[model samples]
Target: MKTIEIKCDGCGADITSTGNCFDYRLALVVETRAVQGPSVTAMAVSLPLDHDHHLCGINCLDQWRDRKRHEAKLWSDWNQQWKEEHATKDPSGRILAWQSPPREILDARRPEFEAAALAAFPMKVTK
Candidate 1:
């Protein structure tokens, strides 16, 4: 039989033979650019990508999963609040105007997202 070594993505703990290792994959798409005026277009500038995480045990996996779930919930709440507060309707009550969260708000969450992704892997600094 071929032997393989599995290491925890969070703490870098060896999990080979433990049968407790959990593997998770995150599929993500990043928008690179937006164009306005004339054509007025947004494009999917990134190819599909997948991030894989292996956890040594349930605790690590649970932590990672919980963090992601919390972020998703927060985003959902924010979207709902924004829609309720800013949506505008015409005389016919047809929705006419709405806006997404400001760029600053979206930018602010970027680091948090990056941190969460990084937490699933060993940290290394390259010069």
Candidate 2:
């Protein structure tokens, strides 16, 4: 079987997805507060199909499917750890700490990501 060659989206750097594909098949989990309480969810994972690194887009669905259970278990385990680490005296013992990211993370990072968006919408918005 022939190996797949992927490239970086920004620098066009080549990425080799050979025997260590699992290493790249990572799941990014984001923690947040919900009506039920705290919740952890998958953000993205690597796709099994070949993709050019020159176009590495984050797809939480594709990446987490392979390890959905593992990711859930990880979140459960992490929740337990968080509780233990931040046990309070009041007794409610709830983390009550996780918060959503500020718009600044997107605002600051939007500039970096705008390149891709602009590329996709070329000729529509010229600067």
TM-score for every candidate vs. truth? 0.41, 0.23
Regions more than 4 Å wrong, model 2: 1-64, 92-127
**Candidate with best lDDT:** 1
Off by over 4 Å in 1: 1-50, 90-96, 110-127
User: Model 2, 104: alpha-carbon shift in Å?
Assistant: 21
On a 0 to 100 scale, what is the lDDT of residue 15 in model 1? 49
lDDT of 2 by residue, 31-118 (tens): 3435464775556954544442222334433322323344345446655665666555345755555444457653565454444433
Put down candidate 1 lDDT per residue, 1-127, tens digits, no spaces.
Answer: 9988665544556645434665443222344465556875436644443455666456666655565666566667767777778889788866788988789988897677556555543333211
lDDT of each: 0.59, 0.42
Task: Count clashing pairs, candidate 1.
Answer: 0
